[model samples]
Target chain A: MNKGLLIVLSGPSGVGKGTVCSVLRSKMPNLTYSVSATTRPPRQGEVDGVNYFFKTREQFQEMIARDALLEHAEYVDNYYGTPRDFVDRTLASGKDIILEIEVQGALKVKEKFPQGVFIFLMPPSLDELKQRITGRGTEEQHVIDHRMSVAAEEISLIRYYDYAVVNDEIDAACKRIESIIIAEHCRKDRFMSELADMLPASEKV
Target chain B: MNKGLLIVLSGPSGVGKGTVCSVLRSKMPNLTYSVSATTRPPRQGEVDGVNYFFKTREQFQEMIARDALLEHAEYVDNYYGTPRDFVDRTLASGKDIILEIEVQGALKVKEKFPQGVFIFLMPPSLDELKQRITGRGTEEQHVIDHRMSVAAEEISLIRYYDYAVVNDEIDAACKRIESIIIAEHCRKDRFMSELADMLPASEKV
Candidate 1:
C-alpha cells in the first residue's frame, strides 16, 4: 500500500474551509481528519477522542514539552494541539491525514514536514466575505470588520501555500481540493520507491 | 478569463499514454490535443493540420532555423516538431493544451517553457509492458525486444517529470491525469495574481 499524505489546510475564519472540508471528507474514503487535543472544557454532548482529546492545561504543556504534539497554539487562554502519534499512525496505515489549522500552526507544520501539501482557501471577494460574515448574524459590525482585516493579512500569505482554492462555490472548491490530493499522490517523488521495485533486472544494475 | 495550462506528457512507447490521453480528453472538455508538424509524408487518408501539419523538409529546416518550433527532433531522416503559434493561440483562448511527445522533446519544451506541467506515464511492470508491446502482434519479436530495451532508457528519465501515473488501470490513470491538470491550476503562483486583485483597497495601499 502507498503511504498516506499529510495535508495542511488553513484559511481565515470566514473562508468556508469547514464546508469544503466536510464535502471533501465525504467524497474521499481514505481521509482521516485529525482530531485536535484541547484544554477547553466541553460545552455539552461532546465525547472525548470524538470531539477532542480533552487534556488539562498542565497535561497539554507536558505534551508540548515532550514534543508529543505535532503543533500547538494558545488561543484565548485555551491550549489546542495536534497530537503527533495519531497523525503518524494514520499515515503509516496509508490513510491521508488532514490538519485544519490556523496560518501560524500550518507554517510550523510546513517547516517540520516540508513534503506536506499546504492549501490555503480564499473567499471569492472581500465584499462577498463581508457579506457572509455579516449574513451569519452572530457577530457585531465591528467584529466583522476585524475579521475582514485579519483576512486581508492572511491573503498576503497565499504565496507561501502550495495551492489556493477560492470558495466561490462549495462544490467547485471541494472538487479542487480533491484534485489536489489526487495530483499529490501522482508526484514523481512519491512513486520512486514503488518504481524501484518494478525496474527490470538489467536496469537494476 | 484565466489563461489555459500547457501540459507536456511523455513516456516510453507501450506505456499506454495514448489510452490515458484519449480518456482525459474525453473527460476534460476544455483540453486541446496539440497536433505536431512533421516532415514525414502523409499516409493514406491523413489530413494536414488534423493528423499532422505536413511540411516539406526545407520548410521544417527553416522552422528550426527561425526557432518557430517549441521542440523538434529528427528520426529516420524526417523531423517532427511542435509549432509554438497554435499552442499559444489555444492557451490564449483559455483552453488547456496537451503535447504528446517523447522524453527528449518533452525535456526540450521544459527548458523553453519552464512553467509547463510535465508528466511521465509508466507501465505497471517491465514484464507487463513487454507483454503489451508483444500483444499488439504487429511488431516482430526482435522489434519488440528492441522497443523493450529503449523503454528501459526512458524509464530511467522518469525522475525528471513532475508527476508519473502508472498505467495499471485505464480509468484510474485517466482520473489521475485529470486531477493533475486541475491541481496545477490551483498552484499558489497562479492564484496570487488573482488574490492581489481581490485585496481590499485600503490594504492595497
Candidate 2:
C-alpha cells in the first residue's frame, strides 16, 4: 500500500488560503487536516485537540526543544506549530493530510519534509491581492504597502513549490489543488517501486 | 500560450492501447493524432497525409538518412516512421497530439523527446495478459508463450514511463490517463515560467 501524500498549501497573507482550505476539507472528507499546536487560549466551541492543540508556553517551548514540532513560529504573543507525529501517522495509514500555512512556515516545513507536495496559491493578480488586503481596511496605507512588497517576495519564492495554483475563484482553486494531489499520487517516482511488485521475480529480466 | 502535450501511449501487445486511444480521441475533440510515413502501399480509401504519408521504399530510406523521421523501424517488408516536422508544427500551434505505438517505438520517441508524457498501459495481471494473448487465437501455442514472455519483459520497463495504468476496463483506464494529463499541465516545471509572465516587471522583486 502507498503512504498518503503530505500536501502543504501556502501563499502570501490574504490570498484566500483559509477559504480554499475550508472548502477543500469539506469536499474531500477523507483528507486529514494537520492540527496545529498553539500557545493561545481556545475560543468558544474550539476544542483543545480539534481546533488547536492547546499548549502552555512551557509545553510549546519543550516541544520546540525536543524537535517534536515540524515547524513553529511566534505570532503576537503566541507560538504556533505543526506536530510531526500526527502527520507521520496519518500518511502511514494511507490517508492524505493537508496543511494551510503562511509562506515562511511552509519553507521551514519543506526543509524537514522534502517529499511533501508543496503548492503555492496566488491571487488572480497582484492588483487583486492589493485590493483584498485593502478591502479589510484594518491596516493603514503604509502597512498595506509593506504587505504588497512582502507578497512580491513570496511570489519570488515560487520556484520551491511543486505547483502554483491561481486562486481566481475559491471553487476553481480547490479543484486545481485536488487535481494536483491526485496527479502527485500518479507520479512516476511514487509508482516506480510499486511496478516492481507487479512483476513476479521469475518473470523479470 | 502553453504548448501542446506530446502524449505517447504504449504497452505490451494485447493490452488494449488502441481501444483506449480511439475512445480518448472521440472524447477530446481538439486532440491531434500523429500520422506516420510508411513505405507500404496505401490500401483502398486511404488518403495521403490523412491516413498516412505513403512513400516509396527509396523515399522512406531518404527520410531516415536525412534525420527527418522521429523514430522508424522495419516490420516484415515495410518501413514506418513518425515525421518530426508535423509534431513540431502542431505543438507550436498549441494543440496536443497523441501517438499510440508499440513499446520499442515509444522508447525511441522518449530518447528524442524526454519531456513528452509517456503512459504505459498494462493488463490487470500477467495471468490476464496471457489470457488476452491466448484469446487472439491467431498464433500457435509456442507463439503465445513467446508473446507472454515478451509481455513480461515489457512490463519490467515501467520505470521509464511517467504513468502505468491498468486496462481493467477501457473507460476506467481512459479516465486515469485523462487525469494524468490534467495533472501534468499543473506541474511546477510547466507553470514556473508562466507565473513569471503574470507579474509585470515593476511588481517583480
Per-candidate DockQ vs. reference: 0.63, 0.52
Report the Cα lDDT for residue A99, model 2: 94
lDDT of 1 by residue, B1-205 (tens): 7789999989999888887888887888678999999999999999999989999999999999998899998899999999998899999999999998888889899888888999998888889999999988899988998998899988888877899988889999888888999999999988766776888666551
The residue-by-residue lDDT of candidate 2 on A1-205, one tens digit each, is 8899999999999999999999998998999999999999999899987899999999999999999988999999999999998899999999999999999999999999999999999887889999999999899999999999889888888888888888998888888888778767777678766667778797552
TM-score of each: 0.95, 0.93
The worst-scoring run of ten residues by lDDT in candidate 1 chain B lies at B196-205
Most accurate candidate by DockQ: 1
Per-residue error (Å), model 1, residue A43: 3.6
Q: Give the TM-score of candidate 2.
A: 0.93
Candidate 2 per-residue lDDT, tens place, B36-70, comes to: 99999889999999999999999989899999988
Off by over 4 Å in 1: A200-205, B200-205
TM-score (C-alpha) between model 1 and the true structure? 0.95
How well does each candidate reproduce the native contacts, as fnat? 0.76, 0.52
